[model samples]
Target chain A: MSVLKVAGARKSFDKTQALGGVSLELGAGELLGLLGPNGAGKTTLVRAIAGRVRLDGGTIELFGREITAATNGARAGLGVVPQEIALYPLLTARENLSVWGRLHGVTPGDLAPRITRALDWTALGDRADEPIKRFSGGMKRRLNIACGILHEPRVLLLDEPTVGVDPQSRERIYDMLAELRERGVSLLLTTHQLEEAEAHCQRIVVIDHGKVAAAGTLAELVEATVGAERRVTLTLDRAPDRPLPGFEAGESGVVVRAHVRDVAAEMPGLLGVVRDAGCKVTDVEVRSPSLQSVFIHLTGRELRE
Target chain B: MIPTLLRIAFTTLRRDRVVQMSVFLLPIVFFTIFAAIFRSQTRGVTAGVRAAVVDEDHSEASRRIVAALAEEKGLRVRTAARPEGAPRGAAEVPLDRARALALVKAGDVPVAIVIPAGFGAGFGAFESRAAPIELLSDSSDPVAPQVVSGLLQRIGMTAAPDLFEKLGFSLFERYGGPMTGQQREAMRRWTSSLTDTAPAGPGRAPGRRSAAGDSLSASIVPVRIVDVLGDQKRNPVVALTAAGIAVMFLLFSASSAGGALLDEVESGTLERLLTSRAGMGTILAGKWLYVTLLGVFQVTVMFVWGMAVFQLDLMHHLPGFFIMTFFTAAAAAGFGLVLATLCRTRQQLGGVSTILILSQSAVGGSMFPRFIMSEGLRAIGRFTTFNANALDGYEKVFWREAPLTDLWPQVLVLAILTVVFLAIARALARRWEST
Candidate 1:
């Protein structure tokens, strides 16, 4: 059964329709990535599921129990990490974790062990007693995530969890999430990092203009949007006199590209054409379609735009 | 490059409403409030010195003096009381010495005039060694007593000229042979029609009595100033000053502490907390409680400093002081929360709270004595601003030395205001919950 499910959630802020019937689900022990361009309703859908937002028309179910703003009994099982670093700057890391733990109804007996584990997980054991204001951006981001998971909620919502952090911290955060998944804690995270989503997420849900544009694994998204054709490229020593048949010249006349389903079978023929065109091929390259291309194909815009 | 920098700064300032309000509007607001306060003190309708009058001797001279005092535009004379704790239909009785003294003690009037039993016999007897007229004054307001004393001297000269003339004739006879009956009769006829026209009125001549005028007019009336509170207080003005400054700064710090809510909202912590087990109401109540406790601590520190350095007599008034302090801090915390919730950003809260607290402080007697303000402005401060009631409660504790039970009215008003302010803050805070 799904640990968290939001179906047909609709929300409008003033005249702007922030979420128009967007729906997604987080399965038990699954890591789901919510992908969208800016203002694409990923945060709105997450907020609705986390009970921070009231949906105009929708149902949010956690562990098979319906959750609404008024009926929030199931909310205790949900944890949310906002896009901004929400911890008090002057407070120590342990203090912030303790506060968030208590706020989420963690008992005193369990708070200490949870904070200890969170400190170890974030790799800030020695610096746990220091004020967070003195911490680096990546350290603060790790602690921000630690603050959210102290209560041991079944479903976690992380919005831009790696936003302003270095790559080393990002790797550590994904490792931490992988451990949580190993412990059977389902997670739903929103990110503009398409590469992170492709590498770590068990499933991806792409939302655009307040609606879900595509949802599936990387292979499924690739097949649905840009298809699974690998592109072959040849870098010529000099400019070609005429265009090669069955190949298009790149922006630089010295480079030409062609798409092929099977590179092993098609590369020799492609290389023969380069030679027949009186162009010596200096470098040959073949690459599969990536999530970025799939995202651009689906949204018709870059993720950051 | 300098011109570009200037343009950049100007453009940013123009777009920032908080900067505009702080730079341009706050000064205008403060200037207007201070101008109104000073104007009311000098020439407004409530500029008159409120004096309670007691007439022990109802002789012709005493009655004439009382009449002239009542006619003086600079003095507001109250000669009767409706009887304290009396029924609604109780007949008003003339003010006696005890009632008049009570009025001065209770701060109902700054000063009280007592026309002694033999003041009429000694009227204008330049060297007769007669009993002097008594001016019972509360020393807290140094201005009212002085103003009343000067006006009394002017009234003594202008109100009863015939008595002066009679004494002058007797003195002339005693020194240089008896005056002729013709001369005495002529002087009496000339002084009988003197209508007490001295050009001495409020906001004009007598109101501006200087040191020179005071000395020149000192001999007309043998007046004794009895400071009602000076003898009891170690440092006479310290209590009022401490209370006023303490309450004003209490408001400033409380609002500042309440700005933590805005900070939480801006930092996204509030949204995170809302998703926790605690609801919005719980979060607000926690913040209000924190700010209230902080305010209490802030005021205690101020008063303790006052006691240590300035001899404020805080230890003597502990019970009433604590009671007033708790309620005052609670109300101020609520007021601060209201300001925080009413504005969106810290800058907006800063500009808005500055205008509001300063305006309230000026009109509500924190910056100056409320008794000296015009009656209209006093009423506005009492009705609209929380500072007035809070200060009144403190005065009752420190100045009047009244028991804690006497503070019910001020405490009740502050308690009601605290509830009202919290309600307004909570209502305004709805924007942060589930939006």
Candidate 2:
């Protein structure tokens, strides 16, 4: 069963329509990456699902139950880690977790253990008693996620959870998210990190201009946008004496570029052609279409723009 | 570098709304409030002095004197007795001598007058032995007694010219020569008859006017004002000022603390809280609770400090003081929440709250006594939470020794304001729950 489903969610702020009929689904244990350029309604979609932003038109469902007119209680099983660090600076990590846990209706008897486990999960147990202001950025980010998950929600919505974090911290967050996924917690992650999405997410939904531009796996998006083709380049020791067929010499006349339907199928034949052309190859590189290229191709703009 | 720095400074000042308000708008608003207060004070609008009269003699002459004193526009006379059909818990009995003295001691009335026995007869002959009129006054209320004294002198002069003339002749007789027994006995006989009938002729009764003549001596008033409070030390105005300033700043502090809600929104904590099971009502209620408690604590600290430093009579006024404090704090808390919810940002809240609180404080009598303000201004002040109601309640408790029931109007006003402010705050907080 799908853990979360947002169908045709639409919202507007004053003159700007933040979401224009955006729809997506997340199955149990699946990590769905919400990819969009800045101001493309990624946050708006997440906020609508979390019940923070009221939609002008839409229906949101969890586990096949519709919650279109429900209060915060209807979204009780849903966890949200906003883009900004939301924990109180004056409160200790454990105290912050306790507050959020209580707010989510964790009983006092269960709250203490849940807070301890959450702190341990974030690897902040040793420093759980320290104020959040004393924590490093990465530590604060981890605690921010920990606060949302203490109630053990069935679905989690994270908006740019790893922005401005060190590589080590980013990896730690990814691992933590992976652990949550293993426990059948579906996640809808909104991020500007295309490479992170490409590496970690099971599926991607690209939204632009408040509408879904494309949705698929990495290979499928690449195939759909730029076709199933690979760019092959051969670096030679010296300039080729003659041009090879179905190939052209690149800048400085020392490298040759060839586009092929399949790199594995056409690589040997292309090398044979290079050899016949009297080219001594020192190195060869084959590249497939990337998520960045797919994003740029579909959105017609850079991700950060 | 100099030009670049100057440009940056000017640009920042122009761009920042909070800075612009603080620099240009605040001074003008503050100046207007203070100028109004000062101007009203200098104009000397008479908010009447509260006083009571104890007619111990209960004679027509004493009653006339009481009536005359009551006619003064500068005095607001209250009988020692509660009016007939007055509501339960509001019964105040008219002052007898002991009760009048007690009221004076409690500082409830600035002055209380006692018309002793034989005071009526003293109106007939100036040389007659009469009990003096006692003026019991609170040492703290010096100005009210002086005004009362002046009114009494005017009444005495109007009622009795023969009394003064007889006293003058007696003084002259004693200084000029020793009177023979026959002469003294004849003078006494003439003085005795003055009470029953007007003197018949010259030397018929010493210093008496003819029965046929219409004269100022038709009635004699030998009243003398004796100050009952001699060298007593007390200053209730200090307590008034302390309470006024304390209540004013307590409101400002509560509003500033309410700005914490804006901080939460800016930090994304509000959104996080909203996404939880806690609804918008719960979040707002929680904030209101915190602000109210903060207000209570702030005001308590101020009063405690006032008691220590300025000798404020907190202990004597404990019940009324605490009641006023609670209501004032609640109203302030509600006001702060409304202000915070109405503004979009912390800087906006700061600028708006500063203008509002300062204006309220200035007009409300924190900066100046409401008693000295013009009637129109005082009417405006009565609408403010602190100036009109809370500070007045505190003063009544601390300086006037008024009963708890007497403060019902002020309590009702504060309660109403608290409800209104909270309701508005809740409505405005809906903006946070949506986009």
Candidate 3:
């Protein structure tokens, strides 16, 4: 069963349409990645689910119960980790956890143990007493996530959780999130890092112009948008003046590229053509269509103009 | 490169609205307020000294003094009062000694002049035992009593100079032996002619060499000064000063504390809080309560310092002081929140709060005594700024030794203001709730 679902979510801000009939769903223990460019409806949808926004026309359901802005109890099971560092800078890491835990309705008797567990999970146990302002960016980011999950929310919404962190920290964060999923906590994450989403997410949803552009697994998206083909490239020691069959020349003319269905079967024939063109092949490479290519195909590679 | 840097600086300044307001608007506002304050005195628009007159001696000499005081442009004398709820054309009852003293105590008039029953019997008897005129005053004004006392002396000398001459001749005949008939007759003729001549008009005596410790002025009127607030209050001015400074700084600290909301908005904590069980109304109430508590603590610290170092009677007035402080802090906190929510950034809040609080302080008797301000500005301060009501309430407690019942007006006004300001702040804060 779906843990959380947003259907036909619509919102408008004066003359600007922020969201237009966008729909998506999160299943039990699933890590769904929401990908979009700037000005997409990802944030608006997240806010609507969090009950901070009054939707113009939409229905958000959690655990098969419909939720609206006035539905205070609906937010009890939901946790939101904002893009910015929402913790107080002057407060200690442990204090921040305690505050957030209390705000999320964690009982006074259970607060201290929960704070201790959160500290250990985020690996901030040793520095929990010091002010968070003295912490490194990666430590702050980890603590930010720990603050949101103190109440053990069943469904979490994270916006750019791993942004502005080093690779090691990013890997640790993904590890922490994986542990949550193992404990049956469903997460719907929004991010600009397509590589991380492609590597970690079970399913991806791309939104453009306040509408859902595509939603499916990596294989399905690639097949529907760009196609299941491997891109091949050849570097030559000299330029070929004549046209090469089934190949396009790059800007330098010393480089050439082509697409193939099976790399093992076409590699030998493609090499024969390079030799026939009187070009000595110095290097060869084969690449599969990735989420980045699929994303670019669905949403064009342009600024938010 | 220099020209490019200059252009960049100009462009930045043009884009910053707070900087523009600070540079251009603040000075103009300050200048206009101060100019009006100073011009009220120099431009001859100063309000006349208000005095309540009670004449128990209804003799010709006492009547002449009252009539002369009424004619003087520098004094507004009230000899009768209409009872409460009376119509505008109702018959005014003559003021007695008790009624006149009530006027001084109630702060209706800063000074009250009472002529004794035997005052006209010995009008100008310089060396004889006679009844002295009594001046009952509320010294908080520091201006009306002195002005009225000096005017009384001048009016006594000018209103009946012939009486003084007649008494001088009688004294000479009694001490220096009887004068000849011809000499006595000539003096009587001269005294009779002196009554026909017009007295010097009530104007400033030109180039009069005045001494600081001149007892001659006091001897002319034979008056006794009575302070209606009594003499037991120690360092009363210190208490008033502390209250003024405390209230002004309380507004500053309250606004600073209220800016924490803006800080949370910038840091995204407010957004996080909104996602919690707490709604927007709950968040605003929390902020208002915190700022009000901070303001109370700030003003209490100031008063405690005054009690320790300046001898302000804080222990005696504890009950009234706390009551006034709570309401004052609540209203000030509301005002602070209003400014914080109205501005978009911390820099903008700083500029706006500074201008508003300073202007309110200047007009609200925090910088100077309200008695010293023109009547128009005082009315504006009382109606527009909460500071005037707050200070007035403190004065009743510390200066007048008033009972708790006297604080209802101030408390009621502050409560209304607190509600209004909080409502405005909440409306302005709707932008941050969503969208």
Q: How many residue pairs clash in each candidate?
A: 0, 7, 0
lDDT of 1 by residue, B2-116 (tens): 9999999999998998889889998898888878878876673457888999989897678878987888878889999878768979988999999899888888999999999
Clash pairs, candidate 1, are none
Residue range A1-305, candidate 3, lDDT tens digits: 89999999999989789889989999999999999998888888888888878899979999899999877576777888989989999999989999999988999999999999889999999999999999999999999999999889999999999999999999999999999999999999999999999999999999988899999999999999999999999999999978689899888888899999999998889889989888899988888999999999999989985
DockQ of 2: 0.63
Once fitted onto the true fold, the runs of candidate 1 whose alpha carbons sit more than 4 angstroms away are A234-256, A265-283, A302-305, B1-3, B184-188, B191-216
Write model 2 residue lDDT over A124-162, tens digit each, in one string.
999999998999999999999999998899899999999
- lDDT, candidate 3, at A59: 92
TM-score of model number 3: 0.92
Residue ranges of candidate 3 with Cα displaced over 4 Å: A234-256, A271-283, B1-5, B43-45, B56-59, B81-93, B126-131, B175-216
lDDT of each: 0.87, 0.79, 0.87
Pairs clashing within candidate 2: B80-B93, B80-B94, B80-B95, B81-B93, B81-B94, B82-B92, B123-B220
lDDT of 2 by residue, B293-351 (tens): 88777777877887788776677778887888888888888899989999988888889
Best by DockQ: 1
How would the candidate models be sorted by lDDT, starting from the highest?
A: 3, 1, 2
Locate the minimum summed-lDDT window of 10 residues in model 1 chain B.
B197-206
Q: Candidate 3's residue-wise lDDT over B1-435, tens digit each?
A: 999999999999999988898899999989998888878756543666789999999986788788888887777789998764479898989988888887787677888999889998787776347688888988888778787788777777767767777777788878888889999889888877777773543533323313311445756667878888746788887888888988899899889989999999999999999888777788889999998988888888888999899888899999999999999999999999999899888999999999999899988989988877777888999998888999999988998888889899999999999999999999998998866
**Using TM-score as the measure, which candidate wins?**
1
